[model samples]
Target: MIKNLLLSLIFLTVLSIAVQAQEALFGAQQIISPEVHDDASVTFRLLAPKAQSVQITGDFLPTVKMETPRGTFDGPGKADLTKDDKGVWTYKSEVLKPELYNYSFIIDGFTTTDPNNPFLIRDVASATNIFIVGGGHADLFKVNDVPHGSVTRRWYDSPGLGMDRRITIYTPPGYENSKDSYPVLYLLHGAGGDEEAWINLGRTSQILDNLIAEGKAKPMIVVMPNGNVIQDGAPGEGSKGFYKPQFMVAKTMDGTYEANFKDIISFVESNYRVKADKSNRAIAGLSMGGYHSLHISNNYPNMFDYVGLFSAAIMPREDATGKIYDNFDGKLKAEMDNGYKLYWIAIGKTDFLYDANKEFRAKLDAMNMPYEYVESEGGHTWRNWRVYLTEFAPKLFNQ
Candidate 1:
């Protein structure tokens, strides 16, 4: 009896070990042909060991419902994976609509990858594969020759924030003429991004230069300011990811953002030969920057005639009993209708802020305000903002 019990215990332990080993090695491998036409379908394949289950999950197909075949199986919109005679596994997914999707594979409860797709983006700690269904708008990195705009790094003193902030400005071709005074667009960067973001990551200078040269856009000055307040020195000068906590706190404070605007406006007026009037001044930004633009412009309605919010964080409200624009009173509504040539709000269809922008747009509608709301094929990325600036610039100062 003791010998039999010992033998059974050893068998169970060995089986547990084997099961763990199988779980570790039984992950799904690469995906093939991520993008497909809206009307058409594409097959996705994965590599796995025999007798293991593989499931695909993503923004399009959030649930792990479909199974992949063991070896190189093709199906419509979905597939099942099982082990083949060769000990390999594969599955194909169906055609999807035109949009950006984030997808991953699950093998025995462990998430895996699709090695076939090249377009991947970092999602915090882990990496995920991105697939685009339809064609996208013109990218900033893919710009052809147009009179290019140049970006400059400038330092400014912020008395309110008690830090020396850094700002970036984009000057169009002929800006060196000294006799020329150009309209200025004060663009703000979002959280986790600095003044350089508009030029480096956002590629605002390239987009403006290309658009201006091609006669697709009018030449204008773009000023990008570092929006954080807790940093001791200029933006991008401190430790990376260090200012994040302070930025988060400052973002919620209306006064802190107002101080940033004061510093930026003062710096522009002091340094550049810019048209300082409302007619020639504009303010725009994305995400947090969008929120800043909305509040700053509305607070000081006389400061900017063109205000743009790309994926804005704040909604439009006329009940300004305690808010920044409370001083504008009925004039806020009247000026919005007439004084501003363009009050534009743009967001991507798949962006997290799509619902926010929609709610804000509805608020504008309730107030009977005049503004332009645009929805395109993208998320909260530089691709959308670059195109937004390109399209928004020409419409400005034209009237």
Candidate 2:
């Protein structure tokens, strides 16, 4: 067809322009230059013979992270890269722990990802090169000889948002034929992230698959929903509507996702052979999604029996947040006093919201409410979030 021919021509033209741009910027540079040694040390090489200076920055580097409320994971850490006589920039990192890390290259004060590393994670508004340090404690994120769950892109009608939104669903291996109803974990993403955030960057599917195969985790379904209330879904999904200012807002939509939480839950329960009781339901998220999980658990106590907060952001303006009770502490205490499997919170030592999470933990402790607290060494990055999920998923449905 004429239309198809025109589209193909346009694509070819764009591809040609992009290739030309890349060639102009990085001509004759050996970009894919990461060599991981047996001791977990990695040597990164970048072809930038003409650059004035280059520095490598990642979570593995040592730097003091700011303790302010809005602290970011962008800086406070960097390593000077040395350019060899061959015009290749190189930086050898210290022995890193087994985990995933996001890094970038600073070329003449400009922040850029590793040109050779094709695997990068798209964050709120930026992209970062990612590498996985294998062995030791990070085996959960690794691929193993295990039965893997399938990830499917599906849509559900959101009456509250007045649109059809997409969610990435992960049904455990054998779910297709297994007639047994399975418990579900409603996973949510952070700001500027779509449903693919967890599955791609966090490696939720691999973690779950590995854990389940090891019998460390329960074989259940994971439903990762797009947390943006204003937007129906990510680009290329065909469901995303015209951008609006409200779409930029983090949360608190009168007719947004939280308002229609039940809609997604209902659709999943109805469509999938899932267990329908509260004890069979769990919810967890990171950052903005973590805030939603906390508040949603508060607003509807009986909806989910298991709640997880990963680097949860607790606004200082306390408006029925984790800080204080809706009105009385006794009410929430009594509600929690009832049977619930687990209430877990995890955060890194350098998390900007570490103080807020500690305060929330103290509040929960003061109420004599049982909850688990995990403090790891890292910042507000996918590295910690992925570890939290690996630990959290195993703890679920155990009781």
Candidate 3:
């Protein structure tokens, strides 16, 4: 009886090993969906044998004018994929520039991300597969052989907002071992983004790690706080259960975030080893967050010595009312008088807020406020914002 039991156990173990080997071999045979070639061209593959059609859409492709219920705007251009005998669909694009790009596949008229590709990026509610073309401008966004920084998601009490808020903070490499207190950069995200926006979509940690490793940027602490006033955190992260994220949320552009901005500073100063003075402090953001940074820095003129606005919405909403928005011209003049180290403004020429930025620059010019300006090619996009950040970060605290 003992001999028979041993034989049965041996047979089961051999069967398990054979099954594992077969699974591994099958997994290895799967197609590589996003294959970045040496010439910066990309080949995307999808296995949908039974589907009638396969289409791909991404930012890399030329955009076509799309009509929506609200209005008409440029949307991602779509292209059909060619199918092979094995039921695999494939599409190869011309040479693409060095930047992070996201694409989605449409199988039988249903839009979805690539199943073969594991890397994905979530912008608000929509999620898509992403790939990187390694080369010039995108090199900083890629993680190279460098000492990495630490990113922490911590909760802090916001007495003004009357909630416990979540914040994303990045400490430079060797921060744990070193006893040095570093300067702080309060980096805000655009509308529809939360604390994780900069870290995930913006590639803040990777950029900082690469920049710091190259000695181009200083070793400073970065603090990303949720700019939305009503929400405690990102969608599904707060008390509210998993809910779909929207592009626009209430109290986004209101002065509440700016008014309560001090709470974030207080929390960071109290908890982290950072230089709490104005000279060692900097503030910057994109889109609506840029609007927030502008007002926050102007209202509290003594708080930050460096300010940046990237594709910022320079106009206040008509119904938006608060003390922070009350005396904008006066506050700006006061900010000018106080003298900041670097007041940097950058926007793409084709951005929707270009005119608003132009008007704001005119106001700054009228007041003779010293600020550096940069104009790039593109609309309001993460690509432009990432470039702005890459250029803006090196100029901070240099004086």
lDDT of 3 by residue, 266-369 (tens): 99999988988999999999998899999999999999999999999897697478778988899899999998899999998878799999999999999999
Candidate 1 local lDDT, 1-399, one digit each (tens):
999999999999999999988775554222344535456454556555443677666656533223444222111132356556655555445655544456676777677667667666542134567655543434333445555666788778888777676778898888886578888888887765666667765668767887677676667889988766555433336544333233343443344665457777888888887888889998999887897787788767788989999987664433323345454436457567556778998998867677878877876788889898889875776657767877888887777
Q: Point to the candidate with the largest lDDT.
A: 3
Each candidate structure's TM-score, on Cα atoms with residue i matched to residue i, is 0.63, 0.84, 0.93
**Candidate 2's residue-wise lDDT over 1-399, tens digit each?**
999999999999999999998987677353555677899999998888899999988777877545455545545488899988988988888888887777899999999988788888766556788888887557777788889889999999988778888889999999988898999999887766787789988899999999999899999999999877666777545454433222245444222456568989989998999988888999999987887787677667788899999988765443334322245355467558665788888999877788888888888888788888899987777878988898899888878
Q: What is the overall TM-score of model 3 with all chains considered together?
A: 0.93
Backbone clashes in model 2, listed as residue pairs: none
Per-candidate clash tally = 16, 0, 0
When sorted by TM-score, best at the front, the candidate numbers are 3, 2, 1
Root-mean-square deviation (CA) per prediction? 11.4, 6.1, 3.2
Worst 10 residues of 2 by lDDT: 316-325
- Local distance difference test scores for all models: 0.68, 0.80, 0.91
TM-score of 2: 0.84
Error of 3 at 173 (Å): 0.7
